[model samples]
Target: MNIEKARFNMIEQQIRPWNVLDKDILDMLIVVKRENYFPQDQKTLAFFDTELPLPDGSKAMSPKLEARIVQELGLKKQESVLLIGAASGYLAALLAHMSSHVTVLETSLALKELAEKNLAADGVRNVSVLLADGLSGQHTGSYDVIVIAGAVEAVPETLKKQLNVGGRLLAIVGRLPVMQAELITRSADAAYDTRSVFDTVVAAAPGAVPSSQFKF
Candidate 1:
């Protein structure tokens, strides 16, 4: 396969048409060698418009979805990011390029090691992968951005509080056939604004909790 051609095709065909028009983000997609982060057997699917399987059985978000998330988050070079689910470290690498630092949380040891190996091999020094349950809401320190790389029933309030006053969070929320991709911005000490970016269904993050039975 012509690697560069394939990569370009992915950007033009899959990512660009999906409304990922940010030039910095589009350039980052080219700079971040995604095939390097894929599991050995899945390298061929790196640029395909599908969620690639990870060693831990979790799914890496598709190319377009990943691009959209990054665009919506609008990461700044001075910002710090907390990324949940280090499936392949691809997203972390992308976040690292757009932010000053990235702390990735993962519950799967296999995935943690894989992420570390990939990030190091790619010389992505700004990312740190931690083997921990990210959904537990026990993460230390505040962040300018938080990304839940999988579908969840809802974003926990505790997790929301971990964001700095002007932080932004991207999470795929809902269950089953369809889900909404939401971008939440912390506007003030106790106020937050959420906007639904798009709707798509992806795999769920490990240990992701569902919404309660009762409804208002």
Candidate 2:
């Protein structure tokens, strides 16, 4: 396959059309080499407009969604970031380039090792991968930006507390068929403002608590 051509097509056809217009972000997509994070067998699907399956039963977010999340967060060069559901570390790799430091939380040990290996091979030294349950809300430190790499029924309050004042979070919220991609910003110690950015559905983060169906 013509690698450069395929990559360009992915940006023009999948990512750009999804409203990802930031020149820096579009350029980063070119630099990041999404194929590098894919398993050997799945490398061919790197630029496809679909979620690629990972060894841990989780799925990589589509190229467009990933770009959108990055653009919406509007990260700064000196800010710290926390990424929930690290998966293959592709998103962390992207975040690392634009932030001072990035920490990824994943529950799967195999995935943690895979992420570390991929990030190291790519020379992304600013990111760290942790093997821990993201939904547990037991993390340490505060972050200037938080990105949940997958969908959840709702953004737990515990997770929100980890954000520094003026910090921003991006997540896909709601159930299947449709979900809202929302950006939440912590304006004060206990005040947050949320705005729906778009609508899309992706795989739920593994270990995310499902919303109770039966109302008592």
Residue-level lDDT tens digits of model 2 in 121-215: 99999998988877677877799999888889989888899999999999899988989999999999999999999999888875677778524
Error of 2 at 92 (Å): 0.4
- The positional error of residue 80 in candidate 1, measured at the CA in angstroms, is 0.3
Which pairs in model 1 have colliding backbones? none
* Candidate whose TM-score is highest: 2
**Stretches of candidate 1 exceeding 4 Å from the true structure:** 212-216
lDDT of each: 0.90, 0.90
In terms of lDDT, the poorest run of 10 residues in model 1 is: 206-215
Residue 149 in model 2: shift from native, Å?
1.0
Could you tell me how far off, in angstroms, the CA of residue 30 lies in candidate 1 after the best superposition? 1.0
What tens digits encode model 1's per-residue C-alpha lDDT throughout 1-216? Answer: 888999999999999999999999999999999999986677878989998877777778899988888999988999999999998899999999999999999999999999999999999999989988888777767999999988899898988999999999999999999899999999999999999999999888766866675356
Could you tell me the TM-score of candidate 2? 0.96
Please, what is the TM-score per model? 0.95, 0.96
